[model samples]
Target: MAVTTSPVDETAIGELKAEVRGPVLQPDDDGYDEARTVYNAMIDRHPGIIVRPTGAADVIAAVNFAREQDLLVAVKGGGHNVAGLAVCDDGLMIDLGLMSSVRVDPDARTARVGPGARLGDLDHETAPFGLVAPAGVVSITGVAGLSLGGGFGYLCRKHGMTVDNLLSVDLVTADGDLVHASEDDHPELFWGIRGGGGNFGIVTSFEFELHELEEVLAGLIIYPADEAHSVVRSWWEFISEAPDELSVWLNFSHAAPEPFISEEYHGERILSVIPIYSGNVEEGWDVIAPLREVGDPIADTVEPRRFVDWQQAFDESYPAGERYFWKSHNFKSPSVEALDHITDYAVSPPTPDTRVSVTHLGGAVNRVPSDATAYPHRDADFLVNITTRWHDSTQDDECIAWTREYFDVLAPHATGGTYVNFTTEPEGEQSMAYRENYERLVALKNEWDPDNLFKMNQNIKPTS
Candidate 1:
C-alpha cells in the first residue's frame, strides 16, 4: 500500500521556514534525507516538510502552521521509535533532535530534560550528582516515547517505571497552545500522558524525580542454549522472591561474535541473564550467587560498574540502521507450556541476531495502583519481547512471518495486554494495549484532542 502525499507548495514552504528559529526542509533540501531517517532502517517515510524546532516556541509555531494547513503532524524526538511514528508521509514533521538537553537540580533531587534527550543523555547529566532517573535499557532510546509508553529498566524494580518519577510535562496541544501538565494543574491530562502513548499531544520537556544511584553490580551471565528451559524456570523462581534492589532479564539469542564471549560459543544459540543490583554491591554478590551456578556458565561479565556504563553495554547490538521487528506480550506468570514454546523458538530463530527476552516485572513496579496512571498492567509478572533483526530487505517476509507465528503460539498463554512502546503496527489491537482503561482513555482523548489530530501513534479514538 503506497501512501499518496499532497504536492509540496514552494510558497508555503518558504513561509514556514521564516516562522521558526530552526531549519525547514523539503525533499530536495540538503539535510532532508538525514532529518527523515529513524532508528529502524525498515521504516522509510517521506514527509512533505520537516521542521527542526529549537525550543517550545518553534514547536508551537510548527503545530499552529500544521493545523492551519490542515496537514497531519508527526513529532520526532530521538527518532528511536521502532514503529517510526515520528515520520509520516505528506505530514509536517517537527524534529526536536537539536533540543536535546538535561538539567539536574541536586538540592531538589529532580531533572528537567528536553523531549529529544536520549536515555544516555539523561544518565550522563544526572550520574555526576549521584542521581539517576529510571529509564529504558537502551541508551539511544528517546525519553519522550519511552516515558509516554511507561518506561521500565534496570532501576525499575528498585524505584518504579519512569512515569512513576515524572513530575511534570510541557506540551503543545492540538489547539497549538503551550500547556503545562502536572499534579497541581491539568492533573487529568498529566495522568493520561503518563502511559497513554503519544495520543494526547507533543511533549517538549519533562521533569522527573531523580534517585540516589552511584554505582551498581550489573553485567551478563550466559549458558548453553540447551539449558534454556531449566534456566528460565530457575530465573522465574529466583526473581519472584528476589529483593527490590535487584533486577534481572533473561535473553535467548545466538551469541554475538564479540571479544568478551568465547570464540567457540560464538554464533551458537545461548541463554543469558543480565542482573543489576542498585543496593550494596557486596550484598548483591551473595544474592546473585545462586543464579551464577545455573547450567555450566559459558561467559560471565558480572561486576561492579557505573550505572551509566552498564546502560550503554548493549548499544552495539542494536545499531541505528537495521531492519527491526518486535512483538511483545505481558504475562501474569510463565506457564511450563509457554516456557517450552519460548525455548523451541529461541533455539531456532530466523536470523542469528533475533532474540527472545523476558524481563522480570515486579517489586516497586507493582506497588503503583493500576488506575493511578494510564499504564495499567502493574499486575504483570513478566514482559516477553521477541525482537527480529535482519540487514537484508529480501528477508523481510520470512522474518516477519516467524515473529507473527511465534506470537500466535504464545498469545494464548499471555495476558492479552501489551506494552504500547513495543507495538509496531496500529491495528485493532490498539484497545488491547490499554485494556480496561481504553474507554476512559477515549473519553480523555475526546476532551484533549476531539478531532484526533495526533492520530499517528497508538490511536485512542475520540468518541463520535
Candidate 2:
C-alpha cells in the first residue's frame, strides 16, 4: 500500500511481481490509484507499473516485460474503455482486470472469452445456455474492447458484428507470441483482429459464435424534448422496414429523473425509443408496435425482459467517475437533410450532459461484405454516438465545443466512417476508423505490429 520511491528497480519490481500471478501495481502500490483507473473520468493516468494479469501466462509475462523494459504499454480489459485507452501516463499499465473469465460451451455453441471479460461476463455466462453474445450495449462494456471495436448491440440486428460472432482469437503478438486467430487460423490475423482496434494483437482469448437468445422485447420509448421532430422522423421511418428480429436505438438525452420519468419531464429534453426484439416474445408484441407508436410517449417500457435484464438497462446512465466526452458517426442512409441535422441535434444541449446516440445499422449489419471483416462500415445505415457526458471539470471546454460543433454539423452527411468503439481521444485520420479497411489495416500493421508496439488503439501505423 503506501510505499513510494521508485526510480525503476526493486529487483526489477520484484521480477515483475514474481512473474505475474496477478497484482503488480507500483506508484507506491496499494492498488496504485485503483490500478490506474480508466473509463474516462477524464482519464487521469499514472502508471509507472501495474500488471494484474493472471492468465494467458500473465499476458505472456506482461508482454515480455513490456518488450524488455522499453515500457509504454496500456491494456486493461474491462476498465470500460472510453478512450483513456486503458491507462498509461508513466507507461506500462497492462491491467487485464484479473482476467475475468466466462467459459460457456453449451455443446460447443461457443464462448471462450476472457481478455478480462465483461458485458456482464458474457451475459452471465451465456444466460444458462439459451445463449447469446452479439455484444456491447454496455453491461459494463469490454468483451475485449467490445470485440475489438466493432461490436454492435441489441443482438446487432440479429447477430453480426461482435466481430461477426468472432469465432477465434487467442492472440498476444507484438512479439510476445501466442497466436491462434480464426477463420482457419492466422487468417490475416483473423482479418486484422476483426475491425482492428487493439491493432495487431494482445487478445488473449475470445471464441464467441453463440446465439439462441431466450428473452427480449425490451423497453424504453420516451418522448418530449418537444417530441424531437416527430421523434426523428419516426426513427427515420422505422429504420426503413427494420426487421431481422428488430433492434432500435435513437436517443437524445435529459429526463432521467427516473420513477419511470414523468415528473414534468425531469431534466427536460428527451426522446428515447430504445426497443429490442430478438424475435418471439409473443412475437415482440407485434414487432414493437410501430416502435410503440413513435411520438406521444413520455414513457413506455416495452415488456418481456431477461436478455440479461435488457443488458443492465443503461447501468444507471453510465456511472463510473463519469466525465466523458465522445463523438462518432457513420451514416449512409440518413437524409432529410440528415434528419434535420438529427432532430436538431436531438433537442439541443451543450450540457444537460449531452447525449444524441442512434444506432440501427441494417439487418445483420448490412449482410457483412465491406471486405468481410476488419469492420469496414458495411455501408452503414446509421450509427451516430455523440455523447458528451459530464460532471464538471469546468465543463470540459463547453462540452468539447458541443461535440466539435455537432461534429462539424454532421460533416457533409457523413459516411466517412468512424466508430472505433466510439473513440474519444486518438484524434481523427486513424484512417477514419478503417474506411476501405485502411490499406488492409496497414498490411495488418506490417505483419503484426511492426514497431507500432500496438499504439494505444485506433492506431494502424506501421508500414516501414
Best by the TM-score measure: 1
Cα lDDT tens digits, model 1, 271-364, are 8898999999999999999988877788899999998888898887778889999889888877888878877898799999888888888999
Cα-based TM-score, every candidate? 0.97, 0.37
CA lDDT of 96 in candidate 1?
Answer: 94
Reference-based TM-score, model 1? 0.97
Model 1: ten consecutive residues of lowest lDDT: 1-10
lDDT of 2 by residue, 198-230 (tens): 878788888888988878888888888776786
- Model 2 gets an lDDT of 0.81
Q: Which residue pairs does candidate 1 place in steric collision?
A: none
Deviating ranges (above 4 Å) for candidate 1: 1-4
Error of 1 at 164 (Å): 0.6
Q: Where does candidate 2 stray beyond 4 Å?
A: 3-5, 8-10, 17-41, 50-75, 81-92, 97-110, 117-131, 138-140, 144-225, 228-250, 253-272, 285-287, 290-292, 296-346, 351-353, 356-464
lDDT, candidates in the order shown: 0.88, 0.81
